[model samples]
Target: MKISNETKIGVLTAFAITIMILGFNFLKGKTLFGTSHTMYAKYTNVQGLATSNPVMINGLQVGTVYSITTDKNMKEILVNMTLTKDVNIPVNSYATIKNNPLGTTTVEIRLGDAMQYLPKDDTIRTETSAGILDAAVQEIRPVLGQVKNAVKSLDSVLMTVNSVVDPNAKNNIRGILENLNKTTAGLTESSASLNTLLNTQTGALAKSLNNVSSFTGNLANNNDKLTAVMTNLDKTTTNLSNLDLQKTLTTLDATVTELKASLGKLNTTNGTAGMLLNDPKLYNNLAATANKINVLLDDIKTNPKRYISFSVFGKKNKSEPLKYPLPDTLNAPYIILQK
Candidate 1:
């Protein structure tokens, strides 16, 4: 068959249009020969979800996001996913947009285990998750706020320090450094002298240390005696502990209580001791009796015949004072007064 140029151009134009359509559908992840179903989901935010983005189920690519549209109120976004017919979406399946760490977004349809499958063009559940950067920003917000506050505090402290610093601070610091250098030099000299002194005394110091070590060795050798002494101390302490100290304390307390009670009784006016202590009349009577005895003694001394009589050869003798027979117990010349 002989074809004309007009027919050839017409065929070429049609072929080109078909190839463009196929290429467009291929780019949109659509299989021209495969059967697919449309599923709908409503989302509040798409989070950079776009058409031609791969829809995955169990990490397998089964569909692509077909279109995104807003509802009448523009409050919710309607997302249409064109999934292959072989991919069965359950009634309660959910479509979620996931973000990768590489800063790319993907749609994932999580298949549920419901026996009922969703009809074509039916709206499934939708959920939105924050992107990696979004989540990172969210987590870092408080830390950044704290860092900002710390920065402000540091700035204020630095301002205060700057204000408090003298204009001659540099000169003062230099002077201080110079003084420090001098001090360091003096310390170096002192250290050298001390090192020399230490060198001179090293032998004596070593000898003293050796003596101390020998003393310690001797002590260590007598450890058995020390142990025995400690054992004796323990036994003494045990014996002291075993004594009835509590009973002794109780007895002492009782004695003290009785003594206090006796003292209290002695202070009362009814007791003999109290009468001796507190009675003025008894004291006066005792004084008067002593005075009368003194007068009697004086009278007896002046008139010997009034108190004494002597008989010599059956006749009365008044020249000498009479003497009564004394008991054997009364050997002394002094009179013994009994109460």
Candidate 2:
């Protein structure tokens, strides 16, 4: 074998190419030199994501970013990653960036939620999230502005609050509080007399209530006796109503029967009440006797001298009228007729 110079140059060029390919694959934690399945990812910004950055699936580096370029037409950076064919990433997995603290570049590619088996050499959906430092810087911008505004306004608020807490003003407030306390003390003193008067009235009210209780107890005791009397009266009235002895109807029926029997006995002609009750001939005789008595009384009323005769032999009429006139005064006459 003749070691020629041209052959040596050709061999070194091939060796350098082999070394570059191995280095690219070694950076992705894959075999040094093998056929890497090509896959692509798109990111919003790939400022520091280099071609040699390792692509890790679940914290295991399995690939490297093989190429990175911003497409002028799409206005998004294209990140083409060379992944080991043995490494499977789920289609729904996410890609996030990792960078150093200086925030100058990102070189770490991490896969998240990579459980599903993706296609060989498939272009997975890309996402670009800022590193913690960059997010912190972005977040701090608004917060720092608020701090600057607060610092600018603090002096005026301090000045306003200082006036309220001043020692002289506190002393004046203390004096006003002490005067109000003295006025409250005077009112408390005045209320002591009112409290005493209320105590006296309370004592009198207790005595009056005691007297009323005694009177009410007496009334209650007497009410029991009164109730007993009323009960007895009601019992007496009920017994009298139910006995039937006091009813005049019973006696009246018996008296009516007995009187009917007596009337039956007396109804004969010789009976005393039967004459008035049934005798028409006796009524006629009584009527005739009444007629004689009426005639006699009428004759007495007409001429009283018919029942008597005047005897005046000692006194002679010395003078007489031409016509003999009846005496104005009827003289007592001797009885000549006897009934």
Q: Report lDDT (CA) for all predictions.
A: 0.80, 0.69
Please give, for residues 1-339, the per-residue lDDT of candidate 1 as tens digits: 999999999999999999999989767766788788788888888888898888888888888888889968879898888886476678878888997756556888888889998887788888777777889999999999999999999999999988988869967988999999999999999988777655645655566777899999999999999999999999999999999999999999999999999888778777899888878889888766655555555556656556675744454435543243234212233355898
| Top candidate when judged by lDDT against the true structure | 1
RMSD of each: 18.5, 22.2
Where does model 1 exceed 4 Å of error?
A: 71-74, 133-339
How do the residues 92-151 of candidate 2 rate in per-residue lDDT, one tens digit apiece? 766667766564343344445656766766767766677677799999999999999998
Q: RMSD in Å for candidate 2, one decimal?
A: 22.2
